[model samples]
Target: MLQRVRLAVFLFVLGGFLPSVQADEVWEFVDADGVVHIGNAAPPASRGLVWLSQTPSARGGSGSAKGKEREVSALRLPGYEAAKPHLEAAALSQSLEPALVIAVAAAESAFNVEAVSRKGALGLMQVMPATAERYGVAGRILPDGKHAAMEPKVNAQIGSRYLADLLRMFDGDKELALAAYNAGEGAVLRYGRRIPPYPETQQYVDRVMRFYRALIR
Candidate 1:
C-alpha cells in the first residue's frame, strides 16, 4: 500500500493527470484490499472502494477550474522552472518566444542542465559542440578550464541563437526550423526546405511542437 502511494505521488509529479484535464472528472479511490485507483470514473461501490477525492475538469469554466488549469501549467514540465530564467534571457536576446525555447529544451533533454546526448550534444538544449562553437558558446575557460556547453546559460544562449538562425534560414517556418534543428540544414534543404522524412526528426518536430503549443496555451 505504501509502495502504491509512492507510485501515485510519482505519477502525479510527472503529469499523469494532464490528460484528465480534458475529461469531465476524475476520481481517486482505494478498495477494501488497499489497492488505489485513479481514473475518470469510480469503480463499483459494492467492491468496497471508498472514494478518497474527486476533481472537476481543468477546462477553466469556473474560478476553481481556472485555478486547476494554472496548477496544471505549473506541473506540465518537471524541470522547466529551474531553467526558466536562462530560457527567458536567451529567448529575449534572440527575439524568440520563450515557450518555443522551453519546448526545444524539453524535447532535447527535459531541461536537464547536465544532460549529454549520445551524439555529443550537451546541456538543456542539447547543443552540439560544433554548433556551440559556431554560436560563440565554446572555448570558455571555466574554473576547470573546460568548454562551456555544459553551462545552462551558455547553452541556452547558443541554442536559442542557433534556433533563431534556423528560423530565419527557413523564412520563419517553425516546422522547417525544427526539422533542421533535429536533422541538419543540409537534410532540410535537400528536402526542398520541408521537414525531412527521417522518423526521428519527424517525431522530434512533433514532440517539440506539442510542447510549444501546450506552453503557449
Candidate 2:
C-alpha cells in the first residue's frame, strides 16, 4: 500500500511533463551564483540547489492509464515518468477526465512534488493537514517536511478525491469547485454559488478553469 501510494503521487505530479520530439525537453534555472544549470536531474555543480524541469516530457501511462478517457501525453513533467498510474487511477476513481486533473496539477504546482506553499502546505497537491484529514488521509508525515503527507500517491488520491468531492458538492460546477479548492467551499456558498467578489478567489477560479478548459479540448 505504501509503495503503491507513493508511485501514484509521482505519476500525477509528473503527468504534466510530456516529452517532445526534436525539442531539448529541458528546464534551465539560474542560481544565486548567476550560473545556469540544465537537465532533469539535480545538478551538483549548482552548489546543492535543486534544478527543476521547466518543461518535461510525459511518460506512457499504465495499462489502466489508457482508458475511455484520453491521456494527455503532452502534459507529463520531466523525469516524473513513475507517476502515470497514480494519475490514471485517481482520475478514473473520481470519474474525472484525467487530462483535466493533470492540467490543474500542472497549473497548481507544475508537477513539483516537493513544492511547499508560503503557508506550510505539503506534498504534490499542496494539501494542508486539516484538509488532508477532512478527506480521510492517513499516515501523513514524511520524515522530510516537504512530503509531510503519508506518501505522494496517498496525497494525490486524497487531494484528487477532495477535489472530486468539491465538484460534487458544488453540483458539478468546476468553477465553484475550484474556488472551494482555493478559498474553501464555505466561501463560495456564502457568495451564493457565484464567484466571490474577492480578487484572489476569483483569480484562482479563473486560472484553474483556464488551464482546465485548454486540456478538455
Candidate 3:
C-alpha cells in the first residue's frame, strides 16, 4: 500500500491528480547537472535527491493551508533555512514580518548569497551598492573582504530596513512599497503614487505578494 501511494503521488505530480491523494506536499531535488526539480514526492535515492519542503493540507479547521504552502515554497530556496535567523532578526528590528523578508529574498535571488544580477544587484536580496549605502550597509565587509551586500545577514538587514521604510513612505500600502522597491519611488510617484505599469515591476510585485500571502498565514 505504501508503494502504491508513493507511485500515485509521483504520477500525480508528473501529470494528473489522484483523488485519493492530496498534492498539498512539495519536494525538491537537484540533479547532477545542477538542475532543480520540484514535485510532490521524493525522487529515487539513486538520483541524488534531496528533500526540500512539505506543505500541509488546507482541509483542516483553520484556513492555514495556503500559508503552509507558501512557507514550504519559501523554504525550498537553497539557503533559506540557513538564513532564517538573519531574516527574523532583521524583520523584527525593522518591525517587518519575517515572512515578507523571506519572500523578498526568495524572489530576489532564490536565496543565493553570492547571486549578482546583470544590472549589478548583489546577494540574496539583490541590493545595489547605492541602495546599501543609503540604508547604512556601506563600509561593511564580509569575512572574505567582499562587500557586505554579499553577506546574507547584512543583506537581509539592509533589505528589510529599506522595505520597512518604503512601506511607511507609501502609507503602509504593501503593493506600492514593493513596486517602489522594484522600480523606484520616483516611478511610483510619477504614476500618481500607484504601482508603476512597467511589466517587470508589476510582475515583481505580484510574485512577492504571492509569496508573502502564502507565508504570512
- Highest-scoring model, lDDT: 3
Task: Tell me each candidate's TM-score.
Answer: 0.66, 0.61, 0.68
Model 3, 1-217: lDDT tens digits are 0000011234212333333434565544332222234566533332323233344353353345644554555556667788788888999999998888887876666666776665667777778788999988776777788888878888888888889989999999989988888887889899999988876677568757766766766
lDDT tens readout by residue for model 1, 1-217: 0112111321222211332233334333332222234454422332312222124343444335454354335324545688989998999999999989887876666566766554667777888888988877666656865568878899899889999999999999999999998887899999888888876677568657756765666
Off by over 4 Å in 2: 1-76, 143-150
Regions of candidate 3 where Cα sits further than 4 Å from its true position: 1-71, 139-145
From the highest lDDT down, the ranking of the candidates is 3, 1, 2
In model 2, how large is the Cα lDDT of residue 132?
Answer: 74
Whole-model Cα lDDT of every candidate shown, in order: 0.64, 0.53, 0.66
Residue 44 of model 1, lDDT score: 31
Where's the lowest-lDDT run of ten residues in candidate 2?
Answer: 1-10
The full ranking of all candidates by TM-score, starting with the best, is 3, 1, 2
RMSD of 2: 11.1
lDDT for predicted candidate 2 compared with the true structure: 0.53
